[model samples]
Target: MMKYHPLPAFLSACAVSACLFGGHAQAASWKAFSAEGGQAPAPLVLPDLAGRDVDLSAFKGEVVLVNFWATWCEPCREEMPSLQRLQQKLGGRGLRVLAVNVGEGVPRIKQFLERTPVSLTMLRDADSDVMKAWRVRMLPASFLVDRHGMLRYQIVGEADYDDPAQQAPVLELLK
Candidate 1:
């Protein structure tokens, strides 16, 4: 019988995801893509850094940026500050940024946050179930959900959230 080690499996998955997304590395801007007839994705329910259960459904009637990331991914780390700035700029205007961390402990995440210091919703995906649910084949993949909970756009690589072009798509969704 073969045994499964979490670290190897996690690393392998990330490696493959990164390779698949490497071609899109030049895509530094968010691209707008609507789901079929604006059909929302599967329900996402995960615990926040505080251990409180946060449901994606709860964010209905608001524009939400669901970003899948990890503390170990350099690109993921790089894009976080922009996300924070985006959050700060539009948060009061009904924009919510949910940074879903895949396969990391709270202590590690907390440590990273201490250094990065982003004030946004941070969710823990210790099992990467949410990552697979969202079909996030890459680290730092992001999706834009409209006010009606429909997924309207997705970014497969690191993005400059502060860019007017990137903010425009999200801003329009909030309207």
Candidate 2:
């Protein structure tokens, strides 16, 4: 058997490691979108619970956290309380958390929210227009919009909204 040189062995290991890690990094990169310094993303307009037009543009000067969720998603349900805690902790400081319920009727949402003890400003995306416009492929997707209406961070799964470390980004922009 031919002996492999230590240099070649190290190089081979490095190459394989790069390839494996690169794919995972690439996938994670796509999971979130960066704002590139407060640049407004593609515009969207959706209605709130009262059926009034709540245009995304209207929240220009506020740090907005838009969460695309559903009553059926367990993770979404799990994170709602955290989000509510986050909102209550920070809502007074120019933070707007819009919990957009995807393709659900008001009665169902109302019934659900009435029992659950989370206090997020809920919006009904019953027609799914907002969901489609935002290209929301997964449930419990979240986007942090800066005060200037730029799409900053996009988290594609359930997250701890109340965690001080996780909420650091939101807090930084709020200041």
* TM-score of each prediction: 0.88, 0.77
Runs in model 1 with CA error above 4 Å? 1-11, 16-25, 34-37
Error of 2 at 81 (Å): 1.0
TM-score winner among the candidates?
Answer: 1
Per-residue lDDT tens digits for candidate 2, residues 85-146, read: 88888889999898998776676677678778777778887766777777776666788888
lDDT (Cα atoms) of all candidates against the true structure: 0.83, 0.71
- Note the clash tally of each candidate: 0, 0
Give model 1's clash tally.
0
lDDT of 1 by residue, 1-175 (tens): 2233356575567757665663245756676664463567778999998899999999988899999988777778988999999999999999999999988889888989988999889999888888888887778788998888888888877788877887888888877
